[model samples]
Target: MSEEGSSYDWAHKAFLQAFLSKSVMTVDEIKPILAAVMSARDPNRPTLEGDVTAPLISSTIQAINERLTSVDYEIRSTKDQTNKHTVYALVNTTSDSLTQLATTFTPDAIAYIKRVLDCMFETNNTRNREVMAVTSIQASQLAKAPTRSRQSQVGGDEDSSIQAEAAVKSLTIAESEKVLADLFDQDFIYKSRANYYSLAPRALMELRTYLKETYNEPAGDDEDEPAIVRIRDCDICREIVTVGVRCSNRECNVRFHDSCATQYFRSQRGNQRTCPKCKGEWLGDLFVGERAANKGQRRTTGGRSSNVRSEEEEEEDEDE
Candidate 1:
């Protein structure tokens, strides 16, 4: 029970009640609730002036803050010097709370994972390369953390080897693989494959649901009128191919400008030229598929063919 002499204690109780209704509050924001607490005040003493109430409010807030410190909770308040005010939040500062915050996958993490998927798709080398790409994203995130506070030493700056680059595109493929090792241990994201990752079934289901409910921007898409646009790119030269020749493969729509295709074919190991991405030869993949399967095994200089290693076969050999 608050003593009759302490108006601040009464105000403290009222502010606590106000905190239940809001996650955060500024001094001005909670004044109305404090004012209402004064409604039951005895008229015996002269009413406290608005200027007099200021110190009492500060005292009441300080009392609650002191109590919060004794527990694992804190009344975190940040002052805005520019605005000349402070905003406060009740925060749980326990180890469990810290662990939860660190482990939860943020939206930015999801975006980075998406970019990794896009990178793999672009390369068409969708091998088991989780460590190759995911680790980079994690490293990039760590590098972005306040390096001064991130130290392992007593007085030195954090020894983070990963340097935070301005953009994800700037990161090399090797760094992505490094950070992915941490994400793998977390167990919320990756799936067990032949040493590669796609996504766990749990993550896949959640992402599918999120996309259907949040990202299906199918409303305005149907009503738009179609417009003719000259869209082309030279696959070999990688330019805005204004003039080009398409690969002879029917399924391949990739273009190469006049002399570019000739030069591209000329650089081929053998007489045949093929689509770089699809591995389609002049016609269909009639012989291209067999050739590609063997190309990795066949030596260009020597006529000997090395055995192609299967994901399962490699694991079996390692066990022996």
Candidate 2:
């Protein structure tokens, strides 16, 4: 049902208020606050807007009541005749039910519901999304890899396009996984199977359970901790990180923590990157004729430096 404010932010604010007060609040009390949050507008609105006509408001409340009822969320409405005020109180549900509700939503409500639920309940959307994305990629890949019988068909444009889509899907999955892997060092932290790396299902389940217990339990005196970023320490600067900020060099595929490498590369606009350790131009010929000079010599700074020194020594001998 349509409401005055964006449902996502509104619901989050409502959840927080309900959690802190240790008491149920009325719908009337929550509506204006939620409306303001959703819009990110000044909280001092002249008055609550929308089809706030009694019937429309009742219908919207009823819709929420019905949705909440399926998941065993208790909601009550009360009006104080003397004060001329109305309020809605939302009671918490069991942790299991909350997790289920957060992860599964109707397509129409998915976007708004996800934001609200994530902010309030703290579900593992990253893992959930990664699982869904990877499964989709696997399905696409399985559908491709044409059977031996189809190899003879040369002009299969439709098949080729389908295969291409599958390839793209696989790449997307890989990229998403890489981001998480780099952030968490999951490849090293967890085991790999057939080069398909992942944390154990039990570990992920534990993470989900801990997050739910930590965030969704009864309100308490302690403040919650912020989200953790997982990254490796930089070799040069030795800064801890969840993901490297930039490559040590474009060709090296070596990454470093942002703080460690920021001084060297952050100011550059483009194509002006250099090695973090050696400060050599990424593609410059440090070994001007090394390939011709020594067939077996590796293209490395030490070898290039020694070659330069050798050349200078030979020129000095000629001068003598």
Give me the runs in candidate 1 sitting further than 4 Å from their true place.
Answer: 1-11, 41-52, 95-320
| Candidate 1 lDDT score at position 302 | 41
Candidate 2: deviation at residue 54, Å?
4.0
Best by lDDT: 1
Instruction: Go through the candidates in order and give each one's C-alpha lDDT.
Output: 0.43, 0.36
Q: After superposition, how far is residue 228 of candidate 1 from its true place, in Å?
A: 54
* Clash totals, every prediction: 11, 9
Clashing pairs in 2: 25-88, 26-87, 26-88, 27-87, 27-88, 183-230, 230-242, 231-241, 231-242
RMSD of each: 23.4, 21.7
